[model samples]
Target chain A: MDLEFSPEDIAFRDEVRKFLEESYPESLRGKASRDEYEREDFLLWQKTLYERGWGAPAWPKEYGGTGWTSIQRFIFQEECARAETIPIPPFGMNMLAPVLLAFGSEEQKQEYLPPIIKGETFWCQGYSEPGSGSDLASLKTTAVRDGDEYVINGQKTWTTLGHFADWIFVLCRTDPSAKKLQEGISFILVNMKTPGVEVKPIITLDGSHEVNETWFTDVRVPVANRVGEENKGWTYAKYLLLHERSGIAGVGRSKRAVERLKEIAATEVSHGEPIIHDPTFARKIAELEVDLTALEYTELRTLAAEAQGKGPGPESSLLKVKGTEIQQRLTELTLEAVGNYAAPYFRGFPKDGDNAYPIGPGYAHMAAPLYANMRKTSIYGGSNEIQRNIIAKAVLGL
Target chain B: MDFNFTSEQDQLRDMVARLMREQYDFDTRRKIASSEPGWRPEMWSQFAELGLLAAPFTEEEGGFGGPIETMIMMEEFGKGLVIEPFLQTAVIAFLQGIIGGEKIFGFAYAEPQGRYNLNDLATTAKKDGDGYVLNGHKAVAHGGPMATHFIVTARTGGDQRDDKGVGVFIVAKDAKGVTTRDYPTVDGQRASEVYFENVSVGADALIGSGDDLALVEKVVDEAIAALCAEAVGCMKVLNEATVDYSKQRKQFGVPIASFQVLQHRMVDMFMAAEQAVSMAYMVTLKLGEDDVERAKAASAAKVQTGKAGKLISQDAVQIHGGMGMTDELNVGHYFKRLTMIGQQFGDVDFHLKRYAKLSAG
Candidate 1:
């Protein structure tokens, strides 16, 4: 089987590369790669992309998106990743937007889609609670109907970008007596500014403030905000979870990491020569490259299936498990390349400060931080252990 | 972009699989194991007639002009416990394709003290007249008992540790002062050690001499790919046999396959086999590229496949209970073949160390 891209796809890739090279601000690229972007800086960067009609390539054009084919979208993302440009955050665009497009009422889509497209509103996910990760149906979040409005009172921990969000899509139990656990849930949207909404930072091992514990107490949301039918939130949640897991594959980002690792290996000396010259290290890189190649092919298979107008089946779990593993390995290898330079634990280094003593190179300060930050990949979007179980049950019928 | 075999390749695989099932059954394999040289010439002739032996070589050398992936197909054949010298023949064909000659060649690099290191040759080759006089003994030469020529490696100039000075020679197996001690391995394969007492050969016998240890390394790496592919095939058979036995074999008033934990273990075996197959395919694809890159990819596949083969074989045996360890069952044959394949072209640790060194660069 061949692995070469079509000439047209290559040309599209070139166009994407050229656009990213010219349009993506150097400051944002540097900060994004360093995992040091502030909320405002991210908004500004996303707005610039939105203004250029380059944001949300995977979304439909009728909803202020580019309406690209799956391969084109894949190409766009890969180029952006290889160029080290700021990524369009998945919470709003990749995760919730698809749900809004497919299941949200027309007026609801009209109200929320424009804001997301214009970068006027940031979104966060409210799927997981204290007790409901892999066994997500056991969630304790509650939404009670009270005349024209529903009061949402629950807590969502590990809320990525919750502090910056103006809106959130949550899955809460709307039916206490429904027979099946999956039949008692409902999907609803809530404004972050609603009364009694609070976001408390949950500091991760990386010492980053990207995640938070969001609590909603007596938060009022109009009945119009509910997506689809009542007690059908599990269906919508499953749909959204697929989107989340698919993006979690991170094929583009891993490709970029491999490139950056190669560059660093070429420059860094290990045994009186560039580390890239070391046969062992080169072989390790090559091994990762082979894995990355296989992952890329698997991704293409998924995309090709989507192009044929089908949602991902059990094979998506395979992609999710292997893709995240590869990304984790890439991050580990990146840190390994930096060696002792990545050993220092810089807690909360400012994004725009001059106080931090940059380690090894300007690029290396983020190695440890990136490694620490990515520790949650396997935990979120379904843990690898959970994915294995899914594979065993769904694909192998075991 | 596509990850499927062509219709022709598909038919070829199916044909080979059917032929293996019908003609090369377990009883036939046992007979071959007990034979004089532990191999059947009629089987080799059958493969040659089927054009399987010539699939991986070029038409210029009486081959099909196919790529290394063709050789991978033959490797899978070896995994079915087929008692034949496919690897020995394919490797000779591959070297002949590269060296551009009709001369028969058998690899003579592994030494008693070298420990699977291809470049660690101790034999010396000194210039005498218009040729070189080889003075050393080569051990564990597969197919050396029947081959017409020997592709011998000898220390020329550099230090023992210096891989740069190793030279490769194609010496006639029947040359004067040549002696052989042939025997059967535990896996029912024949191999021999040959002594070189001033065995002289013309300068034309040298394939690619001098400090080109890289080429020598490539030959070894390619051989590893072939061996890994064979192991993959063997693992596939073992996995399928285990699954079938688990479904049919009963225990505690029910089929053993009804157990969830055992099913999960079998699923894991399937996953390992699938991953190994994917990596082996990739290694075959990269075989004709840059030497270092090829070596790196080949070593990764070799490492992964070697380890996975061992695990799957062991698990297959465990799934069959006591029957798996007995000589009457085919599962035991796969176990022995997998063990032999592991040590054939540098074991898992050797490849992993190689992979780590290349990656650490």
Candidate 2:
């Protein structure tokens, strides 16, 4: 019921703010704000956070975590959002680290957890196949166990950041004739550099190479890379998805978008007044703030529940549904605010590219691309429709 | 910040929702809207008994609820599509009126020439020895016929479109030299074009003297937030109803829900409803803040709700196909109400401009 931060919380917040101001890279901040960053830029920030012992706030305390309370974690996230720092890739940290901690053998944990925390290794998910997207259990990808190795052959589509990955954690079928579909699957980790493994780029509507289709043809994976028991991939995959969906709310980022929207509106003029003053445009910003505020509350509520030792529950589905849509809307509104500058296609963005001169205000360059990229939010981390079905069954008892 | 609703607020919402469910069902609402007053007196009394009428005012103003409580109640009322003048009678009038008790109230502010500007008033009330002589025309005064009292905005000293010198006066509905031309609005609620021809009122009738511009703006903003909440409720119903209909109605020998295109459209409609709900909650929470920020938040909310409402209602009807246009179906009524809600206070375009102006220092 109380929103006021305690004196200790305020002190902690100030400490975190001081650290960010002092340590966050200046050059990295510029690239991050514009959302034009290389893998090295992301890892640089991750290394700094890791060095400060704040690498994985959600990780168990034993796994190099800060062991901060949920509220403190929320505060740190809020600060990161306000700072608009390029996000550390989620595939390695939030998604795989938790599964490794829960299901990995001692050797697996010792070998994998350290590099992941230090940002030395990159990871990508190999769950979705061409025909097995929403219905992931129907995946035809198989890995036959032969002696001490499993020969894998399959294609995984929509492999986000697969080109940047050193390794991939896949859901592969080890038993094709099991009584149930979900029971035949096994979780296996594979090195991206293995023989017969290929990563083909997927240039999306935004003309970015952020995703890839990874193909595995008779790639041999050691049995030691299997997580937990055979035929238990679905359980691990579901667990990883829960971790993924919990943070998909993206409250902090959306708040930043609102600030960005205000900045753009304050500068752009229409009929002699700043567009922000134009009731038509100002109203859109105001309405967005409202939706963002509600979403902020919903996220905080989820955090509060987590503070009480409760998992995200079905409400995470609600968050994913609303959060992604709001993100999409923010980008759409941003593109609208930028006017004709958001021409859906850019000849060259930076100074040295094909088109010599940048088109509009530096801020307007990313608006259209960001809008197109955000479409994946609703589709990925399990599509929003699947989340709705989850809500219907779990929350609504349908 | 903590976002959990207090148990009391949750209980209040539940109570209002239950009452709407049992007594204010769609059939009863249709009957009441088609009747003489165009709203139910019994329902108004019940709301009064439940303190719903006094929920938006402060404790100093003899009311129990704050802005948050008002938001909760309004959201429930919105869900039920309640035809009562809670916004006009309680939110605008009770707060602005010189005296308030059992009587229903209406706001006579928007002039024929003023458009959406509350300050653009050609209506003038010249002061006499103890009272004022009022002469003006007020267009689209919602809840006009049901209200026993009227809160009229008039220009006392400034030019027709000036922001200053505007006064709020309380005029009795039965007063002499007053005329009201009443008709049903598109949303099935009653409104009026009220006229004041040399109408006289005592000095005591001036609740806020000619310079209460901020007060007028705040009240209107609150009303706008409440209306946004109502739109969110209607959008919620429209989305669900459309989905249900799509699942049942077959095309190409399969239910329309089987089509991926229609499913994606439903998802879009659902997201719009969710975003509208979020924005409505946001604006309602901002209602009690400092004037500029409050106005800015209100306009932002109005814009979002208007957009989301339009998208959801129109998409709902389109998904439902031809039957969606019929009066027998509830989607058309929701669409009509949603359309009117957008035009209230200010439409999306107007609010966007207002937000831009207010945002600039």
Please tell me which predicted candidate would have the highest lDDT against the true structure: 2
Q: Model 2 off-target regions past 4 Å? A: A347-358, B1-361
Candidate 1 regions exceeding 4 Å error are: A1-4, A350-352, A355-359, B1-361
Instruction: Report RMSD for candidate 2.
Output: 19.0
Q: Cα-based RMSD of the predictions, in order? A: 19.8, 19.0
What DockQ would candidate 2 receive versus the native complex? 0.02
What does the lDDT come to for candidate 2? Answer: 0.80
When summed lDDT is taken over every stretch of 10 residues in candidate 1 chain A, the lowest stretch is: A340-349
Fnat across every predicted model, in order: 0.00, 0.01
lDDT of 1 by residue, A298-339 (tens): 899889889899887778888888887788778766765664
Chain A TM-score across all models, in listed order: 0.95, 0.97
User: In model 2, how large is the Cα lDDT of residue A105?
Assistant: 96
* Candidate 1 per-residue C-alpha lDDT over B1-361 given as tens digits, one digit per residue, 9 for 90 to 100: 6777777677777778888888778788777766666666666667766767667776786676465546557555765576555565566436543222233346677665465567666788888888888888776777666566677788777876576788877778789977876655545566667789998888787777645578778877777777777778888888889999889876544677887867998999999989888887888788888877898998898888877876786567656653464455777677667756765666665678788888887
lDDT of every model, 2 decimals: 0.74, 0.80
Which candidate ranks first by TM-score, i.e. highest?
Answer: 2
